[model samples]
Target chain A: MTGDGKFNIASEKHGESTVLRPEGDVDMSRSSTLRSALREALGDKPSRLVVDLAKVEYMDSSGLATLVEAARNARTQKVPLVLCGLTTKVRAVFEIARLHQFFEIADTASAAIEG
Target chain B: MADTKPHVYLELRSDPVYLSGARQLIASVAQRLGFDEMACSQIALAVDEALCNIIRHGYDRATDRPIWLSVWPGRKDGQDPGMLVVIEDEARQIDPTIIRGRELDDVRPGGLGVHIIKEVMDEVEYEAREPAGMRLTLYKRLVQKDDSQDADQAGASPAGSADQGRVSNDG
Candidate 1:
């Protein structure tokens, strides 16, 4: 995990897919860190990008917006983006904004990569 | 008995770094008022969104401006017990009527904060403050076991249509 004080991003490469696990509350103060990590991961041109959110207990709209931007970028680059392991609170934010309709979600990172 | 109306007051600069602190305060208050875990999370998220809007738009990304937050337990007089959060900002004031979340079909990075705030809170009110600023009041009522269905349905309103709050110019 690449640590930036309270927030950290653990990135791994699984064959052609890259999984980014962000730990800590993904709020406005820490979203830019996640955004930078996603940009770097996407820049590597992985065939599939999976974000694991099992450890994220809280996420504000800024974090959601960051992911939305990354989703758009991934789509434009033809990199399949999958989000997995969303906690109940994080999932509610997506559902509230009606963004659940826009992204591909999976129960786990392994499921995302294999399926 | 008179309503004590105990409340917590916080004053901070308009900086994103302080968002989490504000969220924690509101969430703790909501939980203390008997909101479930999910409801507490929702309340915190709504308050975070409101503060974000103030810092990003109202303060125009200036982090040094003043933002005041007041949180208290909801009134119990014929009303469901919950939590109430009022955020006051000394920044640029605009037409309260025009503050709204964007269309969901647009599919963009920004503009989702307002929608999240409206969706999570049971009541939202925006009024222009005197001189120059805005006051945003958000309320979330604790739901009884049998009333969960009604609360769910109320929060399930369509995105853009969730702008049912009162907006007035008091400046």
Candidate 2:
């Protein structure tokens, strides 16, 4: 589905893992697109899934909810989901929500895949 | 000296797409008021969350409903310079006592919007409008740590860009 002008998500293979790179604002409006992409990515059933948020400038609670749901699904499937390259602003949101301890995070996509 | 920047009142449709526009408007006003990049983003994010609450839970995702947003730079009660954001919606009256944000440790969705708003803004007030609906007012103090950093602030558009938005001195 087209994310309109809000954001873009592209899927690529990184070693044994599948990486979903989403760039732009991830608010309530663009979150459904991200959720759909995650669902499709998990359909591949990769051993590991990593979301690259390096280029994401903003993310609200809806965006956070999408990641949480994806992580839960991945856990049940025994696939690791790693989030990487969060901007300071986005990182702050996770911290404020006290969700930093719940999800696996890495400094880069490659680092996430390695771990 | 107290800040007396002109107030800008924006009336928008409850459409989710216009949310992006609202964030841009608040960010620009906050930046020009001397808020730093992070501060501006925080203010914008808080306002966005408030709008989301109105559009989703308040208006039941009705895109045609009306939402009112007002912004002005001023000093808070404690003498700190800040911006005031007032959002009004003619939707169902939410119980203010039961409107507490959920504990964050649960690791769930759907409840973080109000939590984020309270965390980012300095003061938050919710009031039932005169006859119906709810009014949410938020305040954020401007504290610039690095004034030299570039803020991705949107261009200042005169309060009225479309029927969705208009500027007025009196809120």
Candidate 3:
């Protein structure tokens, strides 16, 4: 994908769905970049917003917190938010915080867009 | 015989830019200690959260504050070799007893750092450092290949077990 120093985020649109892909480690240092991308995606008011984390290898609590805040914002905007392709490491973070229960997840962005 | 000696020591500023490098270093060490991929990632995440706390709360987001981290090969009882991570910071100190993860039902950002650290690590202790600042010690036991199946099963279930580990904030 694209590189912004240590982290990268690439965004695209498929029909009414907007997909944001963040690569590399999403930690305290790079979470704000992801946050900004998510906010911009939501601001577009797409029918659905999908975060494809297939490229993200590591995520800490700050990254989780950023997504949690985004999920809340998406809810307020009535935009469906979906997370797909969580690596084992990132999934464990979600599982540890029990955050897996809060967001809609799919195996892939296509599945999220379809369902 | 278990080695309880500190194997690595790191001194860093309270800057988020160094978080990724630190995580990689800790994960590599855990992997070398025989922790599986998942276990290593969890350990690294715990350390990252600890440092984030030190940077955010302890240093009040100041980028130049000093933070010290050390890793020690450890053993729990006479079984299982593991790692003990100690993080020290010189910043505002507070009552460790009052440090608690917020209710998950609140469904909010922030507060999950403490919860994740406690859940991932086998033991977590918070104590006020002398003069100024706090010291957080995290211990996680390495699960053997045979025990990994059981751990995986337990992990698949809901995560509200009081006996999952010990988290003491007795500063």
Q: Residue B58 of model 1: what lDDT?
A: 84
RMSD in Å for all candidates: 6.0, 8.3, 5.3
- Pick out the ten consecutive residues of candidate 3 chain B with the lowest summed lDDT: B162-171
Q: If ranked by lDDT, best first, what sequence of candidates would result? A: 3, 1, 2
Tell me the tens digit of each residue's lDDT in model 3 across A46-94: 9999999999998888888899999999999999899999987688778
**lDDT by residue for model 2 (B77-99), tens:** 33655688888889999778788
Q: What C-alpha lDDT, on a 0 to 100 scale, does residue B56 get in candidate 2?
A: 86
Interface CA RMSD, all predictions: 3.2, 7.8, 2.3
TM-score of 3: 0.89
Report the lDDT tens digits of candidate 2 across residue range A34-66: 999999999999989999999898888899999
Global fold similarity of model 2 (TM-score) = 0.86
Candidate 3 on B15-39: residue-level lDDT in tens?
A: 9999888999998888777665666
Docking quality tier of model 3: medium
Q: Write the residue-wise lDDT of candidate 1 on A13-88 in tens digits.
A: 9999999999999988899999999999999999999999999998888898999999999999999999999988
Top of the candidates by DockQ:
3
Error of 1 at B129 (Å): 1.0
Q: What residue runs in model 3 are displaced by over 4 Å at the alpha carbon?
A: A1-3, B1-5, B75-80, B145-171
Order of all candidates by DockQ, from best down to worst?
A: 3, 1, 2
